[model samples]
Target: MFNPKLHAWLERYFYQPGYFEIVISTLLLPFSLIYYCLVWVKFKLAKPVKFSIPIISVGNLILGGSGKTPLTKAIFNEFSNKYKIFIILRGYKRESKGMQIVALNGVIKCDVATSGDEAMEYAISLKNANVIVSNDRKIAIDKAISLGANLVILDDGFGKADIYKLNILLHPAKEPRLNFTIPSGVYRYPKSFYNLADITLKSSDIIKENSIIKPTDKMVLVSGIANPSRLSFIYDRCVGYEHFGDHHKFSKFECESILKKYNADSLLVTQKDYVKIKDFGLKLSILELKTTILPNLIDKIDMFIKSYQISDRIYSNSQKGDLC
Candidate 1:
């Protein structure tokens, strides 16, 4: 299949949805329906395995850019002091991964290639929580429990049925209220599964307000993420942009070309994109947009922890301090 061209079509189809998408997505709707049905049956046939510790999942039905990563950090921030926590991700598009450890107590060991961009971002972002990369989440979670994690959080794990967890689906503010299944649209799960979410959250709830937003005379928005538009705020002053496929590994030549193509004096990227290329040693000035997981959601999560008896140890008075 023509993957790149299809991806471009999808971007327009999902975000703009004019006559082009109306016709294209309609023709592709049957395929999306079949895929969704197959997935639904797969989940139904699989048995959910419960870990010795609680596994909380932060995910979304939409394809990407729903703020699941920041929300995961938010949950991590809430319980890191009290629980032995670890994050499990599929290490999407990573070179090496069969249950690799990325971080321990906030210290990262592996390069971004061993751990995908999102996992590496978590490793760099969280100073205390451990991050693990594996396509088979069961192996990762089992490893986490063995490594003394009382809680294992799965990132982008909405489709994994092997382990049951607290399902938190994030809805981005900019995302349309309703969405369709993939191929035709960005929704991976049918909208009917909306009721499956234990709690539905708005991405705006976690988006940091004072996000880095200094405008420049000439800026090139550089990113390789599922939903690059989430960083649209950076475009307010952007002269041009270059978006590689999600989790794309950047080469020195590519970075240099992006600079030349846009004739950009400075380069701007999201934290997720920054981790992948921070070591590329590019010459241009790079600015990163930071995301903060607000504190309001913590109250609801804390209550769930207590209700389910997940843990009693919250941050002590001395530890009770800041929000990320």
Candidate 2:
């Protein structure tokens, strides 16, 4: 199978309807279709949880860069004070053996490593909010419930037929929309899966004003994300942008090489890149891009919480009785 990141590029290129990309997706489309069907069936069979608090899922039918984390934080910011909110992430790339609550001082920490970049980012971005990571989301959701979360949010969960309501789906606002699928394309679930979404969002729209900072001199655009283009678009205006893979664990040597090749004096990276680069203790100066989730979406999200308050009370009481 092609790397998911490479597949994202392939899908974008294939959407151009040229011979090379079309022939590639055509050859691979049969297998991609079979896999999609099998996964679709499995998704249907997966057990779902009925939560007391409304669970909003910010996810993508596609594999990467649907902007789940930014949406999660945006929704949380809207209602954190009005209701206790909890975020559950799948915690990709963590070394932890199994599902565990992210903790520091016996509570969740804002550390970007164990909690996944976006999870930690959101945890820290939202004051007094709970962030939990679990491969088994049911367990994670239960933990959040026990922690007195009145609303639970899942990041990067779309096709999973587990507990999700009020689905907020994000589509990347790049040049191509539906250009790819699995091995040859970036989509994880078929575009039909997007039908499950209650609201459709575009990550490109999240930033109203271009907040990209101008580079002082030569710089390299460092990223460890599925779609480096999103960051690249911002940096293209500033200086030359060099791209890398999603969740790339860059070594000290690699960083040095990138610096040397580009004559780059500084590094601009996504939040996900920050965690790995910090651990490496690289000498490059880093600037992070901030994503702003729009306010109207936040208002609608708040309304959703306010409507679910009574149901949350009953669910909390039921869980207490079961524990007793």
Q: All candidates: CA RMSD in angstroms?
A: 7.0, 4.3
Best model number under TM-score: 1
lDDT of each: 0.76, 0.67
User: lDDT value for candidate 2?
Assistant: 0.67
- Candidate 1 has a TM-score of 0.84
Candidate 2 lDDT, 45-95, residue by residue in tens: 878767766888888766667667666766777677677777888888766
Candidate 1, 171-231: lDDT as tens digits: 7566752266888877888877768787787745655543444445777888787766566
Where model 2 places Cα greater than 4 Å from the true spot, the runs are 1-14, 103-113, 123-126, 175-181, 203-205, 208-218, 236-240, 260-263, 279-287, 293-295, 312-324
Top candidate on lDDT is 1
- Residue 24's lDDT within candidate 1 is 81
Candidate 2 RMSD to the correct structure: 4.3
Model 1 clashes, total count: 1
- In candidate 2, residue 144 scores what lDDT? 82
**Total backbone collisions for each predicted model:** 1, 4
